[model samples]
Structures are given as C-alpha cells and as structure tokens.
Target: MLTRISSVDHLEVKQVVFSSVLQLGDSCILNGFSRALAVQRETEIFYGDEGNFPSYRIFKKPLPLPPITESISFLRHNINPIIKVNNIDVTAVSNSSILHVGNSQTVSMEVRVKHIRQLLLEGHEQDI
Candidate 1:
C-alpha cells in the first residue's frame, strides 16, 4: 500500500457547535481554496478528532461567544474508507498545515482483516 501523510487536514472552531459538528460528515463540504497546496478538483475534506479544537465557555444566555476551553472532540480512524478517490487514516492536527504525526513503517492490511457479514433485508419473515 502507498503511504502518505497528506491524505487529510484540520479545522478549528470557536466551540463544538452544531454547524461545525456537521462539517465532519462523509459528504461534508468546505468552500475554500487550498492557500498553497496542489489543487485538487473535488471539494476538500478534513477528518478525525485529531483535528478538533473546541473552545468551551458558559454564558449567562443560551449561547456564549469566544469560548474558554476546548471540548467535544470528534475523531475517526479508517483503514479502508469508502471514499472513491483516496483512503486515509487521520491522526491529529493543531496550528499547522497537514501535520504528519504517525509512523511510516509498512504493514500488511490483508493478514489482519476480518470479514463483516451483511444482514439481508426481506419483506416477509422466513422460518429458520
């Protein structure tokens, strides 16, 4: 398998709020050009809790501005992500552009994989 540190990136938010949280989904899109990186045609996406920077704060009102501490981190590890273009395993990020913090050591994914059986969907119940 090809090893690459550049498969993913990060984004910082004032707090772990709704709109920001939704940005983590599979088809989530961010509308901005990469400042100085190889330009890819499709919308770019960042992933994992390694990229979460939550600024926490308690307000007298329902919502607060300029949070104090980081909270509610979301991270995911994927060996064989279904994304058609690239498969990635996001580790972590902070105040940097595409920071790489994992090992470059090569390992076989085939030897360790366990098959997951899919359950069939039927209109009527069948006798076992």
Candidate 2:
C-alpha cells in the first residue's frame, strides 16, 4: 500500500505494508541468489545477526504453533521477546539469528494423525 504523506511542500513519502509474511529461525543463513524475489527490506526484533553475516535476514525467531493443540503456553512460559531489528546494513551481514518457537503446522498434522490412529486402533465389535 502506498501511503502518501503531504507536507507543507506537498512532499509525497511512501510506507509499505507487506500482506505476506516469512519466518526464520536463529542462526539461519540464505543467499539472495537463491531467492529470486527482490527482498526490499528486512527487519528483526532481537539482537539478530549474531554470527556476523553478509546476507540480510528477514525475521528473527517466529513462533510456530504446536503439532496438535494450538496453545500459547510455551510462548507465555518463555521470556524470549519479539525484538525490532530494522534498518540493517544488508550488505554487511551474512547470517541472521533469533529465538524460535516450535513448528506449528507440522505439529498439528502429527497430532491429527496420532488421533486418527488411536481411534482406529480401538477394538470395534459393534453390531450397529
């Protein structure tokens, strides 16, 4: 979205709001050569880039939901924070770091399979 700010000089400025989101973990490294999409800007909250990277990292540790039950207990229990590490010197960093939560989708699918397996394993001699 292009937000035009009109100042006294009628200057037009731009602010972007990304509709899509990407997630990354701490000490994750990726080169722009692999990602064809032109990564405009990268931001982080924690003290990312702890490895002295040469590539820009998008997000620090993103929280993934549990395998079966979607609960916020882990997040609440942990003191790790969502830091804002924006306006980075992209050319200077090769890797990014962050506090990561568990993978949500994978966990959910695993839980579902386990549940169905349990149901099927139960003895069934009903005549209905």
Structure candidate 1, residue pairs in collision: 48-75, 49-74, 49-75, 54-70, 56-69
Evaluate residue 91 in candidate 1 and report its C-alpha lDDT on the 0 to 100 scale: 38
Candidate 1 per-residue C-alpha lDDT over 1-128 given as tens digits, one digit per residue, 9 for 90 to 100: 32333333443333332122212323222321111122232222333322122311211124224655866787767676432324334333222122223332322111111222333346423522
Candidate 2 residue 113 Cα shift, in angstroms, is: 50
- RMSD in Å for candidate 1, one decimal? 22.1
lDDT of 2 at 29: 34
lDDT of 2 by residue, 58-120 (tens): 322233754766555532332443433433222221112112222222211111001111122
